[model samples]
Structure formats: C-alpha cells, structure tokens
Target: MTVRTTDTPVRVMIVDDHEVVRRGIVTVIDASPALTVVGEASTVDEARRRLPAVRPDVLVVDLQLPDGTGIDVMTRARELSPEQRMLVLTSFDDDAALRESRAVGAAGMLLKSARSRDIVAAIEKIAEGQTVWPSRPAEDEEELSATDQRIVELIGDGCTNREIADELGIAEKTVKNRITAILHSLGLQRRTQVAAREAARRRAGWK
Candidate 1:
C-alpha cells in the first residue's frame, strides 16, 4: 500500500519521443488529484538537461527515445539523484528492456496499452516509494534447473564466472557455457540482467 505524506500532488515528468503519447500521459497524470505533470521531454538528452531543474517526484518515460533508450535517461537520472523514482511506459513488452529498467532503479513498468487509470495508479505508488513491477511468469522460473538456479544466485551475489566455477567445482569454460544457456532460456542478453533479476526476486521474498 502507498500513502502520501503531504498534500502536494506527486510531481511527474513525461519523456517520450511521440508528442501525442507524451500529451496523453500528461493528461492522465494531471487528471489524478494525487499527481501532477511538472515537465516533459522528447529525447534522452532533453530529459538529462531538464531533470534536475524540474525536480519531478516521478519520471514516466518511454523505452525508445530519439537520442537514446529510456535506460540511458534512467541511468543519468540515477547518477544525478539516487532517490529518483521512475516508471517505464512503452509500447514494447520486452523482457530485456524490463530487466534493464529494473537494474537502473525504475519503481514501476507499464505498457502504453495499460489503462490510463492504471498508469496514474502506478505513478502514485512509485511516488510513495512502492514498486509496481509485473511478476515474471512462474514457468520462466521452472525453466531453470537446480544448478542454473544456484548459478543465478551466485551471480546475484556478485560472483564472476571464474569465481562461480571455483565455488561450484566446475571449469570456467563450463560456467561460461551454462551462463550462455541461462541467458537464452531466460530471454536475457547479459549476465548483469540475470543478476539484477535474481536480486529483485530475493528482495521480493522469492526463493
């Protein structure tokens, strides 16, 4: 549950390359009594330039930008303000993008197809320091063997491939091969994504 500590509406910033999409989100947010639109940007560069000045409570950003991806914007924002809250609102339902956004500390993710009310609700939750991420399918977790799960846990603990191999009594080459297979099975592109997802699951009390 999310609860606001002040009467001030949660200030929101919208970043999307499409003007119409930005406006639509802006409208939805402003219509909420608990949220307000404070600024807007169409590119990662613009977002970087305006973020500090706007000092928004939450940033609602699209994954694809004219200058760079939304991950770039979130990364920069995290550098500038470690406590900054963000939400990814994009047309694409990409697992890689979701993991990247989570790694960069986005508080929530919503597709553009989500209802306007749902978007506003997510912003409110994020503003209050609550997360609103979609749960990964159980079948995805079932795909990992016990060994693969152990590898993921080790990676999340900040172990390198060589370290993981030494810990598991396996050759480094075998560890690399297993990691490659893990990435393929989980629809991830990098070990960092696996680590991030595993860390998130731990935080969520998943075994």
Candidate 2:
C-alpha cells in the first residue's frame, strides 16, 4: 500500500475534474521541494483505475467528480490501498461533505480557496498521519437548542438540577435527562466536568 516511508519526497496524485484547478494545484506542488506530483485523474473511475499504478503517498481529491463523489473514490482507493491517505480539496462550504470525507478515511479537508502554503502544509500533515479537518468557531459550539443551551449554561454556573428545572419552569426529571444527554454528547461523566471544560474554553478566549 504505502511506498518507502523514509526521507523520500511525498508522492501526490491529484483527482480533480477541473483541468485548470488540477494544473493550479500541480503548480503549487511544483514549488514545494518535499512533494512530487506523480499522477492526475479527472474522474472517479479514472482515479480508481490509476490509483494502484501511481501508488501515491497522498491523494489530493476534489469533492465533485464526473462519474461519482470523491468519497466514492476514496472508499475504493482505501480498499485497494488501505495505507493511502487522502486530502480533500473542496470549494463548497458543505459540512456534510467534510463528515463524509472523514467517514471514508480522508486524512484532511482543505478549502479550495486556501493559500498554497496551507494546502502544502495540509498535505504534509496528512502524509505524517495527522488529521487536518477545519476548526469550528467558538460560536458553533454554542449552537445547541435553546433549551439545551440554557440548561447547560445553568449547569456550568453550578446550578443544581432542581434549581435549573425550577428556574427554567421545567420538571426536575426533564432537567436530569437533558443533563445526561449533554454529558453523553460531550463524552463527559459529570456535570462538574462539563463546567470545567466550559471554564477552560472560556479561559482560552473561545468567545
């Protein structure tokens, strides 16, 4: 699956349907000394067919393909070469695409408008076995349902379950259930842990 893992240049293959975009990326890679462009494909079928031949260390893939989704290509490519790493290049701001890419074993997702340096760095990071997904803003973390947000904020303020339920005009049992679900979502065991995480996030200037 993987080629030599030593100090050799990281072999990269581009799978973009747009010819101009492919050339643009190739040009960027040309400027990076640690990378080598080994092949290019404009369609999912072509990428799947050529992946075995190229044996690239990283596959720089676009979300849209002439034949199928890039996730389709990544799935088949991983089946052919499980060690293959993928860096998704996408212009669409679709969160679903990011989720699908990770589900199918993509090592990173890069916006197409990213600076060439960022693209190169993401490639290197993926090649080094590190994830490179986009960071969600602090505001996005507060996107919980209004009730959930109120309950969690109260919990963070050290409000007891009965106190929160009483303040929010809800049953105490309902407050307990919501707290349990919040802990499960955050992979935390206690409300105090949630409070601590929120405190740390606040300290980090997340807001």
Candidate 3:
C-alpha cells in the first residue's frame, strides 16, 4: 500500500544507470504525497559527488551499473553517513546482489518490477527504519558442496560456463552438471538467483 502523508516528506536520491528507469522512479517519487526526488546519478562517481550535496534521507540504488556495482555506492554512503537509510532498486533478482546490498547495510531491497504504490511504501518503510524484502526466504548457500560452491562463486564473478570449466580444469559438461546440481540444491531457478542468495546470506552474517 502507498504511504501518503504530506507532513513528513522523505527526501530521496536516485542512483541507476538507465535514464528511463531513473526518470520513471523520479515520476513515482514526485507523485507520492510524502516523498521527493532530491537528486539522481547514473554512476557511482556521480552518485558520490551528489550524495553529500543532496544529503537525502533515503538513497534508492540499482545493482548493475556501467562503471561499477551498486555496492560501491553503498560502501561510500556508509562511510559518509552510516545512519543514512539505503533502499536498492534493481531489475536483478540475483541472490548475491541482494546479499551484498544488505551486507553493505542497505535498509531494504525492492524489485524494479514492483508496483508504484509498493515502491512508495518501501521508501516510507525505509525512512521509518523498517527492513523490506520478498516474503519468501532466499535460498540457502551452505547447501552446496565445495565444488558446487566454487562453480557458483565463479559464476557470481561473471564467468561463463566454459571459463569456469577451464579454471577448474574440468570438462564443459561437468561444469554444466555441477551448476545444475548447485541450482537444484539451493532451490534456485537461475544462476543470478544463486549469486544473489549467497550475497544476502553473507549480508545477514550467516555461516
């Protein structure tokens, strides 16, 4: 549900590489009765520069970027003001990215496909110090075997199946088989989800 209140306008900074997405998020924030888009950036460097100047109450960041990942932004924001509330806005549902964002101290994580009202609600919830995530628990990372973990870790680093095989000195078919096993064990549907789940678990400080 959309949180509407003109009395407590929450200032927000938008950080995403996509112009269309940044514009869309701005539109959503502007339409909200209690939220305002104070500033925006397309890269971590740009975000770092604008962050202090804007000093927004909440920062909405995207995971994938041209120059660097959103974690860089989170790291910088934490350094500048650890108290600042950070909410990630990303199209990726990768488990590793989610975990990394949380590890870096994001207040919440919202899918980019979320409804406008949900997005607005997330902003308010973060502003009020509430953590927001998907209802279901992300898959566990510790279920995988040592080999499976290595395969997934390589995948998380953006390595292709062939590259993973070459690095592990295994056949391509073997690499694919290991990846399949990893996915099955973790109850994940995608490689990105495996990475994202691992990231979230790490962020949560689980073993």
- Model 1 bad stretches (over 4 Å): 1-4, 141-207
Over all chains combined, what TM-score does candidate 2 have?
0.65
TM-score of each: 0.68, 0.65, 0.67
lDDT of 2: 0.81
Top-scoring candidate (lDDT) = 1
- Clashing residue pairs in candidate 3, if any? 94-196, 95-195, 95-196, 95-197, 96-195, 96-196, 96-197, 99-199, 99-200
What TM-score would you give candidate 1 relative to the actual structure? 0.68
Candidate 3, 204: how far from true, in Å? 26
Evaluated against the true structure, the overall lDDT of model 3 is 0.80
Best by TM-score: 1
lDDT of 2 at 161: 90
Q: TM-score: which is higher, 2 or 3?
A: 3
Q: Which pairs clash (backbone N, Cα, C closer than 3 Å) in model 2?
A: none
List, residue by residue over 30-130, the lDDT tens digit for candidate 3: 99889989999999899999988998888999977777778778778888987888999888776555555665778788899999999999999988778
Q: Write the per-residue lDDT of candidate 1 for residues 153-195, one digit (tens) a residue.
A: 9999999999999999966755765676578668788989999
